[model samples]
Each structure stands twice: as C-alpha cells, then as structure tokens.
Target: MMERRAYPLRISAVVLDAMQRWSEDELRSLNAQIEFVLRDALRRSGRLRPPPADPMDDTDGD
Candidate 1:
C-alpha cells in the first residue's frame, strides 16, 4: 500500500515548456521524465530520498 500525499506545486509556463522540450529530447514520457528529474534534484538538494533504481536497470541478475 502506498501512502497518499500532496504538496502545492507551481511552475511558470516557460519552465513547463523547457521541461517538455527536455522530455522530448530524452525520449521519455513527459510525466516520467519530470518525475525523474525532480526526484534526482530533490535527492541532491536533501529535499527527498534518492529515487529507487528503475526496473530497466535490472538485467536478469547478470
């Protein structure tokens, strides 16, 4: 079970546009890319825990 939570988030149109462009360039879904980037930043800034490794990082135990 996951805990429910919410936080106020605000972003300017210019920032949103830049995020979209970056997501496209990275070949990731916009939501996924945003989550990845934000999570990484938060972890680095001590605002959140480091994100767990993506399943894609697993290679059949090899």
Candidate 2:
C-alpha cells in the first residue's frame, strides 16, 4: 500500500456532486477518485516521475 496524507480542500457543490457521481459510477471512494484524477493530470503534464524499477524483479532471460 502507498502512504497517504490528508489535506483540506474546498470545492464548489456542483463540482463536488459531479465527482461524487463519477466516483460511484466507477466504484471507487471519493477520495480515491480525486487522487486518481490528480495523479493522472500530473503524469500527463510530466510533473510526476515514474517510480524506479525494482531490482529484485529483473526478468532478463539469461
């Protein structure tokens, strides 16, 4: 599991309601849906880097 931190956010009711509906449709909690959207945007904008490869999972056909 990934470490998580909570922060206060203020959003308009319209946006919040839409997000709630979308999250329910996707079967994810509101918090997870919000994080997913933020993370996706960050990745698309090249502002977030991918995690390093795990050395223990090397699969080179030797």
Candidate 3:
C-alpha cells in the first residue's frame, strides 16, 4: 500500500504560472507536474541520495 503525505509549500506567482502552462502544454495533471518538478529539484540539489532499503518510515504511524 502506498502511504500519503502532505507538505506546505510556498511558490512565487511566476513559477506557479509557468508550471500551469507547462502542465497544460504537456497534457499532464497539475499534481503530477508539480511532483515531477519537486523530484527533479531534490535530485539536482543533492537532497535525495540513494533510496533506503525500506522507502517508508513508519514512526509516524499509530
């Protein structure tokens, strides 16, 4: 089963508009485009290294 997470993100109007245009042009969902961009940014910024053996952390689970 896939786990769901939520985050608060702040973005500039110009960047948001660009993302909207890019998503419409590519016929991709807004959520998908945003996720793709975020993943690319994380990789480029070296924030995401190799995946852990278990990708999910259950410490937050009840």
Question: Considering only N, C-alpha and C atoms within 3 Å, which residue pairs clash in candidate 1?
Answer: none
Q: What is the C-alpha lDDT of each candidate?
A: 0.82, 0.93, 0.83
Each model's backbone clash number: 0, 0, 0
Order of models, best lDDT first: 2, 3, 1
By TM-score, rank the candidates, best first: 2, 3, 1
Mark the 10 consecutive residues where model 3 has the least summed lDDT: 50-59
| Predicted structure with the largest TM-score when compared to the true one | 2
Clashing pairs in 2: none
After superposition, the stretches of candidate 2 with alpha carbons farther than 4 Å from their true spots are 59-62
lDDT of 3 by residue, 1-58 (tens): 5466988778899998999999999899877899888789999999977665665666
- Which model scores highest in lDDT? 2
Better model by TM-score: candidate 1 vs candidate 2? 2
- Native-vs-model 3 lDDT? 0.83
